[model samples]
Target: MKEIVIIGAGYGGLRTVELLSGNKSFDITLIDKNPYHYMQTEAYGYIAGRFDMSDIAIDLQGLIHGLGPNVTFIRDEAVQIDETAKVIILKEQRLSFDIAVIAVGAKTNFFSFIEGAREHTNGVKNMQRVFEFRQAFEHRLYAKLQNSQNSLNRAGDLHIAIAGAGLSGVEIAAEMAFTLQRYHKIHSEKSQRLEFSLIDAADTILPGMDPYIIKKTEERLHELGIKIYTKAFIEKIQERSITFKDGTILPFDFIIYTAGVKGADLIHTLDTPKNRQDQIIPDETLRLQGSKDIFCIGDCTEIKDAKKVLLPPTAQVAEKSAAYVARSITRLSEEKSLEPFHANVDGVFVALGGKYALGILFKKIRVKGYFAYLLKKLISRSYRFGLEIKVNAGYKKRHVGSHDTLCR
Candidate 1:
C-alpha cells in the first residue's frame, strides 16, 4: 500500500481524505493540531451568540472512525519537513510518506508593517479567538449596563473598531450591531449605544464584490449605525485605542483585526518557491515545484494564473484543489496522467448579519436579503453533514458546492 500523509484536517486535507479513503491501495494518515473540524465561514454567528459553539464543529476523531482502519487520524502539530527523505516531523516522531499533501490552514495576520496590533487586538480566525472576542465584547457591554449608562451617556465610549472591511470583519460588525440592537430593545432604560467603526486601508471596500452589493451592504450597515473608514491606514494598535497613519487616534473599547492571513509556519520551512506572503507556489498540477511526490492545497499553496496572479485564498478554491488533487492521486495510483487544476471564481456569500446576506453567484448573478442568508446557512450545513457521512462511509458520492467564498 502507498503511504499517503496529509498534514491538515482543513477543507482541503479532510476533503482529500474523504475522497481517497476507499482506495485500498492507498493508506491514509491525517494530521492536524485540532481534533474537531470547525466551519470557519459561519463561525461569526457563534461568536455573536446567535449559534452554539457545537453548531460549527464536528469531532474529527468521530469522523475518522467512519473512514475505517485504513486511515489513521493523529491530533498533533506538524513541525517541519525533510523533503530529501520525504518525512514529516511531528513533536516526537517522523512519518515517511510515498505521497504527502500540505494543507495546513491560515491564521490571523496583522500585516507586519503595522506594529503592536497582533499583541493587542482581537482576532477571530478560530473558535478560541471567537470565544475570547465574545467574552471581551460581552464584558464591555456588561460594564456599560452595570454603570447605568444610557444611549445618550455612552456614545463613543462604547466604541468597537474592526480593522479590515472584508467579509469576516464586516459580518462580525453587523452581527454585533444587530445583537446590540436586540439587547437595547429588551432593556430600553439601559440602551447603551455602541459605536462601530470599520477601518480599511483600501480606498474601497469588498475589493471584488459587485458595486450594487457594496452599496446595499453599506446601506444595511448604516441602518445599524456603523461608521465606515475607507482609505484609512492603521499605524499601530494600543490596548485601549488604534492609531492611524496620520497620527489620528481612535479610542476603542475593543478591536478585532481581520486584515490578512497567510500560510501556517510549517509551509514556510519547505525548500520550495514561495510568494511574498510565504505561501508555497504550486505548479498547474498542484504539485510543489521540484517535488513531484508532495502536493499542496488550500490557503497554504500559491496556484497562480497565467498573469502570475495567485488565486484568492478561500475555502471554495481549496475545495476545488482538494477534489482535483485527490483525482490526480487516484490516477497516479493507476499510472494515468494528471489534469491541470483551473478553478474559476464561482461566487461568494457574505452574511451581513445573522439573518441577512449578500451573494454574488457565478461571478455575475447578485443575490441578497433573507434568501442569500438561507443559502449561506445551507452551504455551511451541507459541508458539515457531508463530512459526517464521509467519516462513516470512508467515502461518499461527491458533493458539489457553488463557488461560495466569504473573503475575496
Candidate 2:
C-alpha cells in the first residue's frame, strides 16, 4: 500500500483526501495545525456576523474519522519538507511518505517597505484574528452608544479603513458599511458617525478583473457610502493614521490590511523552483519540478494556463488542481500514463453586503443584485453538502459494505 501524506487541511488538501480515501491501496495521513477546516472564502460574511462558527468551520476529526480506518488525521504543524529524504518535518515528529502533497495555502503579505503596517493593521485571513477584530468593532460601537446616552461630546467620526481594494477588501468594506448602517438605525441615537474607506495603490479596484465587474462593484460601494481611494499609495502606517505618498495623512479608528498574499512561510524554506510570491512552480502535471512523487497544489503552487498567464489562487483553482493531482496519483499507482492539468475558471461571485452581489459566468454571463447573492449562497451550501455526503457515504461503505447507502 502507498503511504500518502498530505499537509494542510484547506480546500485543496481536504478535496484530495475525499477523492483518494476510497482507494483500498492507499493509506492517507492528513496533517494540519488546526483541527478544523476554515472556509476562508466566506471570511467577509463571518466577520460581519452573517455566519456563525459552524457555518465557516468544519470539524476535521469527525470528517476524517468518517472516511474509514485507512485515513489518519494529525493536528500538527508541518515546518519543512526534506525533499531529498522524502520526509516531512513536523513540529512534533518526522513523517516518511511514499508520496507527498504540499497544499499549505497562503499567508498575508505586509510589504516590508510600509512602516508599521504589520504592527498596526489587522487581517481576516484566520479565524482567531477575525474574531478579535469583530469583538473590537462591536465594543467600539457599544462605547459610542454609551457616550451618546451620557450626553458626552462626540470624539469624532469613526473611520474604518480597508487597505487594498482587492476582492477581500471590497467585500469587507461593503459588509461593514451595511452592518454599521443597520446598527445606527437600530440604535436611533446620536452616536459617532461611521466612515469607511477602501484604499488601494492600483489604478482601479479589483485589478485584473473584468471591467464590468469593477464598474458595478464601484457603483455598489458608492451606494453603500464607501469611499474608494485608488492610486493613493500608502507610504506609512502609523498607530491611528496612514500616510499617503502625496503627503496625505488619513486618520482612522481602525484599519484592515487585505492588500496582498504570498505562499505560506513553509514554502519559502523548500529548495524548490518558485515564483516571485514564493509559490512553487509546478509542472504541467502539478508535480514539483524535477520531482515525480511530490506534488504541489492550492495557494502554495503558482500554476499557469495554456496562455502562460498565472491563475489566481482562488478556492476554485485550488479544488480543480487538487482533483487533478488526486487522479494523477491514482494513475501513478496503476502504472498508467498521466495527463496534464488545464486550468479553467467557470465563474466568480462577489457579495456586496446584505442580499446583493455581482457575478460573471462562463466569462460572458453577468449577474447582479439578489439573484447573484442567492447563487453564491447556494454554491457555498452545495460545497458543504457535497463534503458531508462524501463523508457519510465513505463511513457507510466501510461499515455496511455498501457504497450506495449514505449514513445521515
Task: Write model 1 residue lDDT over 1-408, tens digit each, in one string.
Answer: 999999998888988998998898888999988888877876768777788877778777767767756778888889998888889999867899999999997777768789898898877777787878887777766766766654455433467888989878888889878877787677434445568898898876776567877889899899888999999999988888888999999998878888888778898778889887778878889898877789999989886645665677788888888998999999999999888888776788888875898888886888899999898889988887787775545323112222112111
Q: For candidate 1, what's the RMSD? A: 6.0
Q: How accurate locally, in lDDT, is each candidate?
A: 0.81, 0.88
Please tell me which predicted candidate would have the highest TM-score against the true structure.
2
Residue 104 deviation, candidate 1, in Å?
A: 0.5
Please, what is the TM-score per model? 0.91, 0.94
Candidate 2, RMSD to the unseen true structure: 3.4
Candidate RMSDs in order: 6.0, 3.4
lDDT of 2 at 213: 97
lDDT of 1 at 22: 86
- In model 2, what lDDT does residue 311 have? 77
Residue ranges of candidate 2 with Cα displaced over 4 Å: 152-155, 389-408
lDDT of 2 by residue, 52-98 (tens): 87788887766886786678888899998998899999999999999
